[model samples]
Every structure is written in structure tokens, then in C-alpha cells.
Target chain A: MNKTGKKIFINGNEAIAEAAIIAGCRFYAGYPITPQNQIPEYMSWRMPEAGGVFIQAESELAAINMVFGASLTGTRAMTSSSSPGISLKQEGISYMAGCELPGVIVNMQRGGPGLGNIQGSQADYFQATKGGGHGDYRMPVLAPSTIPEAIEHVMTAFDLADMYRTPVMLLSDGILGQMMEAVEFPVYKSKKKLPEKDWILDGAKNRKPRSVFSLMMQNPTILEKHNYKLAEKYKKMETEVIHETYLAEDAEILVCAYGIMGRICRGAIDMARKEGVKAGLFRPVTVWPFASEVVSKLGKKAKKVLVVELNLGQMVEDIRLAVEDNKKISFFGKPGGAVATKEEIFAKIKELIK
Target chain B: MKAVYTKPISLTETANSYCPGCGHGLVHRLVAEVIDELGVRERTIGIAPVGCAVFAYDYFNFDVTEAPHGRPPAVATAIKRCLPDRIVFTYQGDGDLASIGTNEIIHAANRGENITVIFINNAVYGMTGGQMAPTTLEGMKTTTTTKGRDVKVAGHPLRVSELLSSIEGAVYIERVTVIDPANVIKAKKAIKKAFQNQIDKKGFSFVEVLSPCPINWGLKPLDALKFIKEKMMEYFKLGVIKDSTNSKESK
Candidate 1:
């Protein structure tokens, strides 16, 4: 709980804004988009009070670039948007990651292949985990099943981003962004000292000016070297993988889910156990790197593994790779902005038994 | 005798990579001299555009970052807002600012962000091998406009300074060229005025410099200067289009 007595009943978007404030994020720029609009709405008023800067940018394109600019000045900056808006931001996001600038990007996902309704979906999993933009790079994608977890992820995102010198994503969906819950935000502090950003463009007061650019296309060798450096960073991120397991030590069936779907799976797993079925939940907290080691270990023992999601089986592919011939994988999804209820999922698990 | 011509301390020894007779070198020098004169090099943060000046940061002796094509103005807005005490400016080309990044430039100017835009309108995308730009003239031919720019096929060349000057948030807007020595001095003066406006917190200030690209235009160095004076200047008028602060002070 926040010792400052700052606990409040709020939605995920509002909680994200309050968490950003506590994490020392001093700049925000974003465009208006559904499900995520509350973030910009909340930040618009709260940021100025906290002596920070906020801009309702003309478009998501400009908003990401503005955050990129603020990040280069060695300040904590962030931007939030839905699926379509995140697509428009890919170019700037790619540029930021290429330049190795630290920033936080919140993608409160809405259903999409193209303008797919304003309902929650996990279709953007591959987009976030695998390079969302044109790049040979990756960023830590943190998915939270609850509002408190979302707040916690936002705080951790900044520290990891600054530590890794890459952008970090707080991946959520409309289901979480729109739901109000009683939440207590813990004051966040970096446990370790980060290297001073001598590369930031804060003007050359006592030293020569620093320049950060992404256009290394002129020389093939330069871009190759840059890619090689990014690979090294990605390797370092493997040590920080995190996941959660609920009664997977001895189970016949295991459920793999992320984001809000993971929370839904908890009850479904309990329902399965009540019906004399030994089922468990393996939820990924860091979607990238994906805690594959745990999934691999658990997959070897399980009789059946069901990957549940709100999208059309995107993360199922990762689970398949993690389990790779050790066990056969099955998928259950309610795509097109539809969510599966606990009883509905439990029935699906019953069908898998026979 | 004191040296009358010395390299600006704000300009680096990095040999400019611009083709011979390109105006970017001259414009970059003028911006550096202005920064030197204003004594803001130490506190100046520059946003580089994606055109030929993509490496504009390499040539300057101050802190600089590259923004995706046409997003420098937005970048400058955030940088300037985050550190109000520092001086921020964006250097962009015609294609980057006028075409792809039109909305960003307009909204930033409309918000009256206290920053400067050094818009280089060379009438073509020089870095991308002389493609027809938004500012490419009606009859000008390029790789994309192979048959010359047909107004019906494409559109009228954009007059960026004239367009931006109409916005209330734009405090100072001027269109100047750096073709000749006399006009080069005028261009420098316009740049200084734009930066000075920021120092005075006079909201958005813009300088649209009609620079020349000889290699791209397939013209000789001197003839390129003539092209700007004769053809480009006709559609794009020069001189100050807006001086909101200057007008207010006079009243």
C-alpha cells in the first residue's frame, strides 16, 4: 500500500497514470484512442500538478516522436494508445529502440486486424513480443492480469527500460483498462543505481555534444554492428524472465494464458479441480522471453496443455515451441472481441479430457 | 589584423558530406553562427529531420537527436517544453516538413510551441535522389515527376511559409534564400531573428530557406542560384509573412 494514503478506487488507465507519477515519469504525450483515453485524460490534469509536461499530440505518430525527444533529454517519458494507434507509432518506436533511448509505452489493446471493434483482445501479442516495427530488436513486454499488477508493471517498466537502454511496454487490454478496482499503489524506487546517460541530448554544458540517430543505412557495416549490439542487450534480458504458476506440480491439464485471460483461467482451473480434474495455470508476466523454461519443464509432465486467449491462437505458437514435441498443444480462443467465461472454459477443458 | 573569416566554434570539423554547391552546408553554417552569437550552443538542443540533413547532428557542435521523417517539430516541442530553460530548434527539409510531416508541423505551430523551425525548401528530395517533392515546381521534372509536374496529376507546389504564417500561434514567419552573398547575410539575419524570438519567449518562429540543390537539379552551381532567383522565388515569395510579436511591440 502507498504509505502516503493514496489508495483509490480507479480503473486500470487511472491506476497507470498514478503509478507513472510515483515512478517519476515527468513527461507524457499521446493521441486520443478508446479504452486508453483515460490514461491521457488523467495525465493531462495530474501531470501539470506534478510539474510535468503533457501534450495531446496531433496524431499517434507525433506523440511517439515527442516521447522519443523527451526520453533523449534523459527524463522519464511515456505514451499510451490502442491497437491502431500503436500501429501508427511503430516507426517512431522503432527509431527510439534503435537509438537505445529509454521510455515506457502503454498499449491498452483493442481488437484489431484492421479497426476491429473497441473491445479487449490479445491479437497484439506477437506484435509486442516480436519486433512490432521494422527492426532486428526486442523490448521487454510486461503483461498484467490485474490493475495492481498493471501498476506494478508500469513502475518496473521504467526501471528496466532505463537499465536496458530500450523501450519497455506495459501491455494491457480494454477489459482491464475499463474495469474499476480498489487499488493501492506502492511507491516505486530503483533498487540499483543506473549508469548515467552520457548519450542524452541535454546540450553540451561541460562536454562535447552527444548525437543519437537511427539512420545507419548508408554503410552496411555500421547497421550490422548496431544490430549486433542490440542482440547483446536482448541476451542480458533473458535473466529477468518472470512467470506465475497455480498448482502445476502434478496436473493432467495445464492452461497457458496472459493478460486478463490469465485471471479468467484461475477460476476455470479451480472449476476443473472441483470436477476432479487436475488442471493448472501457467501465466506469463514478461511476454517476451516468455518464461519458456518453465513452460518447457511443465509441458514435459502434463498430459495435455491448453493455450487460452482472447485472440485467434497467437501465443499458442510460443507454447508449441516451448513444449516442442514434448507434449501436444491445444488452443481455445474467443476471438473478435469475445471473452470466455470461467464455466465456458471449464466445459472446454472437460471436452479435452476425453 | 583580426581574422574576419573563421570557422564557427559551434560547427564541427566533421567535413560536411553535402555535395558541392548544396545549400545545406551554408545553412548549417548560418545556424551555427547564430547559435554562437546567441551564446546558446551549450543550452541548445537540435532535432534532425530525415532528409539529406538526417546527419545534421554530425555537423553541429551541440546536442542533437534524429526524429523520424517530418517529426522534428513535434520532437522540438517536447524537448523545449520539458526543459523550458534550454533553446530547442528543428532542422527539416521540404519533403519531410511539407508533405509527410505536414500535420505535425502545423499542430506544433498552432500550439505556438516556443521553438524554432529551420525549414529547408530545396524543391526536391535531395537525399533520395532528386524525387519530386511537395515543393517541386509546376513544370519541374525529377525522377518521380519524369514528365514534369502536371498540376492535375500531382498538385500545386506548397508554399510552406505562406501556409504557416496564417496560423495565429506562429509569431514570426519569414522566407529567405541563401543563393548570393547579400541574400546569405539576409538568411543569417532571419535565422538569428527566429532564435531570438525563442529567447524572448515569442511562441512559434519559422524561417523557410529556399536553398539550392545543383546535383539534383542537374544545373551548374551558379545556374542553381539563378534557378532559385528566377523560377522558385516566383511561386514562393520571400520576406517576412508574419511578425506577431514585432507588430505587438510597435503598437
Candidate 2:
């Protein structure tokens, strides 16, 4: 409780860690990687101080799996990594989704097809939003455009994970991770102590023995039952999808974006508005379990939808699906290390309007 | 009136899910007896591996968490750190411990995490139908090693306990086989000592128990035990490779 209404100047990584602690995260396992190394460093020291567990796993694969183990015990757990390391964690993330374990994964994205760079890039948009691992499962992904949003999303990520009993991702980039910002800490609550062994594998002494497993035995009907249960959980998540629209009521061209690009798109929309052009912005806060209805309702009024992103057009696919080909849509993006600047986005909007 | 020998104290009354003569049941019982004897049952947390023993959570009488393949050590590391006063251990099969989970186990040992690792080395993958495993012996037949593990291609079997003993962080490392009554006694002693080391906060302690997988080995129950003694032991030698107690006494 510092001055400025519980406000503190902190970096993005520290904010993420602080948010996790406030959310009652008792376990953190991660490997060191640039841009997001502060996350593991903060947890390594803070978790121990808070009577939580912190482990610097040997690799990203082990780190994510460690989170899987702790989460299975009905504990709030998380791991953070960059692009290449996040790629290693995909298998475990996929398994967590399959098993319906509640956990959070933070991707402080860097450039990559492979070991691309330690610098910031949104190249992982497709990997974060779409199911990166080998499965038909969807991880609810939150893209944070600002440091405050990064902290807010970290808190929301835990609620969403527990709400749906699934893994959630906080998709950020190096700039946001390393940047410092003024943030107010959330009120901390000591987690209500639940029976540790209620559903966990603490030897079968006090209650009926339990198991946390993802393998559906070779029985097809049982597998189908588990899949059906998962489908029902996903259906409940649809009601929680969220987004924001700015000046879209009379716009003829809609600019759809998310994460950092969404922030830049808002700037572009402002520039277009000054020129007396009817341009509006749709910023999706939740990338997966997407805000499709909002996009469709806005699509009805706009003549053309221009999707802008820092990746090679990943969110554009979701926009297309939401609009359902009913509106003319085109995508303008910069892949690899290039970012979509406000001027570049404004040019794209002008082109689309013509 | 005489008391009958029944399921051990740390184990629940649940019937085992293991195949007949599988070594997991024996090892689980042995671990349970040790926990009960040590009076740490209430404070112990067990980590189950991904294999036939994955459901160990159902039979073991303690709080347990099932880990993904080869991740028990990492999970155990967290639990022990969070609850330092609690006794935490991970029970894993050969494939889950020695293969994909190699890095997790080695790093945990090297970091000297205060936990016990009960490794069941049954030579073959029992759950997924007798696949070739990292511990599968040379000249032995498995579904994946139909031609008898070709050393040139697959490499020789790994001796995990001996390998782990070399790490300075490991406080205790022992390998014991449970094929016969005598060997079962030795295996129990080894497991008990491993747990005792953790109770003493000695650092990482590992007990690799040589188990039998009758279903995967294509042999009868007795024959599987015989195979473990006659064939598997030749590749995986049994003995204590490290004891930090001796080092502590010397100091």
C-alpha cells in the first residue's frame, strides 16, 4: 500500500508476478529467457517470501509440466517464457487443455520461426490465439496492449482459467514486458485453504483416493464422454467473451485489432477521424473464445473492415470468421520484426476506404 | 487370534489397478509401510508418474498429484518448497523417469532438492504395451525393440541410480531389485533409507527399485521374476552407490 492510491511504478514482468500473487498463485516454475526473465526472477525471490513455491526448471518443457502438476493439485500455478521456449511448452499446454487443468501461461513474445531474436515481435499471434499444440482444444488467450492491461489481464487470466477449468495465456511482447508503468496493486486475499488432498494424490488416508490424469483409456465411449464434457465447458466460456469499440456507430470502415496493434489502430482511427473520414476501431481483449457477436454487429454498419496486426495476419482470420464474408475485408500486417505503425495503418485504412 | 498381513498403512483399501504380479503394488506397499513407520503419513505428499502406476493416487493413502510423463521431479520440487515441513516424494516408472523426464530428475538431484524419488525400473514400458524403454536391456525383446535392442541405433540401457550418484547434490542413491523375498527386503530397506534421508533434510535421495512387468515381458508371474533376476540384473547392477550419512559423519 504505497502512496498514489496503492500505486507503484513497476515493470510489466513484475506486474504480472504481483498480479499472480494477488490471485493466490502458490506455484511458479519457469526457465530464464530474455524480455520476460524478470518474471521468473521476481517469482524466485517473491514466491519464497510469500510462502509459495518457485522452481527454475531445467527447460521450458519441464517448467510447463511442473505447472501442470501443481495445477492438478488444485493450486493456482503459472509459467512464463518467450517464443522459442513457449514453443517447447506447447505439448504440455495442449495436455493441460485436454485434461482441463486451470493454469496461466505468459508469453512475452519475441521474434521467431526459430530463435529469431530477443527483441519484441508479435510473430506468435497465431500460436497464442489458435491452438499451438496438436489438438482441437482452444486456450483462452488474453492480449494485453499496455502494462496496466498486462496486469489486469494477468488477474483476469486466473479467473478465466478457474472459471472454465482450462489453461489461459497472456500474450504480450518484449516491449510491454520490459517497459515500466504506473500500476495500482489489487487488494490481496489470502487464499481460502481448501482440503489439499480432496482431489489430489496425497496417499489415500483421509478420503477416497483420486487421480489427475488426461489419458482417456482405450475406451471410445468414455473418451467421447470426456470430450463432450469439455465441449460443454467451452460453451460456457462463450458468454464471457469481451471487446471494446471506439466511434464505430457511423463509421464506414472498421479497423479490427488486438494486443499492441489494437492500441496503434486506435491512434490510426483518430487520425482518420480528424480527416473527416468515418473510421472506427474494434479492439478485442479476449483473443480466443473471441468476441464474435460484437464484430458481427459492427460489421453490419461498416462497409469495409481493415484488420491490422504485427503478425502475418493471424487475428484477421478470426475477424473474417466473425464477419462471415458478409463484408469486404482486407488485412495489412508486418511480420517478423516489423511493427504496424500508426502512419502505416492509416495508409492501409485510406487504401481500403478507396 | 493372529493379525493378518494386509495392505500397508500408507495405502488405501482400494484394490490395485496393476496387472497380476506387477511390481507397482509391492513397491507402493513398501513405501506406505515406511511412511507409516516413520510417522510422516499425515505430512506426506506423493507425486504419481504417468504410466500404469498413474492411478497410484487412488491406492496411496496421502495427498497425491499425477504428473505428466517425466515431470514428477519438477512437481515434487514445488511441493517440497512450498511445504518445507512436509515429506514429499515422487513415484515413477522407468519410462516416465529415465526417458522423457531425465532432465527434470537430473536437475532436481543436482539442485539438491529436499525430496525422495522412488524409481520403479521394470525394464519395459508396461502401460503402453511393452514398448522399448530407456531401461530395456540389450538383447531383450520389446514391442519397439523387436530385433533385440540394437546398441548402435538405440544405445545401451541407462543405469539411472548410478548415474545420479555422481551428482554432488544427491545425498543418497541406491538400486535394489524385488524379484525374490530376500531382494524384496533389500528394496524395502533402500526405500526406507531414502525416506529417512528426506526426513533428516539430507538433500535429494533416490531409490531405484527393479520391478517386474509380467504383462509386457511375455512371461508368467514366476518367470518374470526369474527374468528380472537372471537377465535384467546383469545390465542393471544392484547396490548403494552413495550415502551422505557417511560423509556427514566423516566431517
DockQ of all candidates, in order?
0.88, 0.50
Which predicted model would earn the best lDDT?
A: 1
Ten residues in sequence with the least summed lDDT for candidate 1 chain A = A1-10
In the range A260-345, model 1's lDDT, one tens digit per residue, is 99999999999999989999999999998689889988987898999999988889998998889534688999888988899988
Q: Give the range of the ten consecutive residues with the poorest summed lDDT in model 2 chain B.
A: B242-251
- Residue B40, model 2: Cα distance from true site in angstroms: 3.4
lDDT of 2 at A40: 96
Best-performing candidate as measured by DockQ: 1
Whole-model lDDT for model 2 versus the true structure? Answer: 0.84
lDDT of 1 by residue, B102-208 (tens): 99999999999999999999999999899999999998999999989999999999988888888989999999999899999999999999999899888899999
Predicted model with the maximum TM-score: 1
lDDT of each: 0.91, 0.84
